[model samples]
Target: MLPRFLERLRQQADNLAGLLGNRVALFGIELQEESERLLGHLALLLGAAICTLFCLLSAVVAGLVLAARYGVLLEVCATLAVLFLLLALGLAWYLRRRLADAPEPFEATRQEFERDRLALNGARETAQ
Candidate 1:
């Protein structure tokens, strides 16, 4: 009886270890995904800022004066500057919206753990 009990205990320990390993793996995957998402967001932000700065420099008085000396060139330059700036602004707004809408970190891991907890509790209650 003692030997059988020890064998069952070892099997249960192995099962628990496997379950923990799976959860840990899920956590690692989620963390990696979140980091990738953040990196993408940062790239978008950098792109927008660079676009804004480049366009803003062209919208300066010196640029306008130089374009103005060319008559039709002034209107074209002004329009393009405005368009680029608007595009940059739109990108920034999009990034902001995406950041705000991002899901909580470790969400899947938390959910899985919650399910595990509920199952364990249910089993305990039934056993009682």
Candidate 2:
């Protein structure tokens, strides 16, 4: 009877180990998924930014050419350039603030880990 009991206990331990391993693997997969999503979003944003920059440059050039016909090309171009720079700076600052305010990544995984720790502790105490 004691031998059978020991065998059952060992089997339970193995099952617990496997469960823990699976949970860790799940956490890793979730982390990877979130990282890939963030990277994809960054890439898309970069592409859009490049396209917007090209458009802005073309518009500025066209505006300058039109102003030349009106005899104030230099002044108009300078003012437009300064305005665009200030706008870009303002947007960059705002984006920085928004990113800083964003929640920590992998929050779900963190919560799951905490719950698992508490559960394991409770189990251990009960067993003792």
- Candidate number with greatest TM-score: 1
Off by over 4 Å in 2: 1-9, 86-103
Q: Among all windows of ten consecutive residues in candidate 1, which has the lowest summed lDDT?
A: 55-64
- In candidate 2, what are the lDDT values of residues 24-76, reduced to their tens digit? 88788888977886787688669768986898889898898889889998888
Q: What number of clashing residue pairs does each candidate have, in the order they appear?
A: 0, 0
Residue-level lDDT tens digits of model 1 in 72-111? 6768676877877777678778877887899999999999
TM-score of 2: 0.72
lDDT at residue 11 of model 1 (Cα atoms): 92
Please give the distance, in angstroms, between residue 66's alpha carbon in candidate 2 and its true position after superposition. Answer: 2.1
Model 2 lDDT on a 0 to 1 scale: 0.81
- Against the reference, the lDDT scores of all candidates come to 0.84, 0.81
* lDDT winner: 1
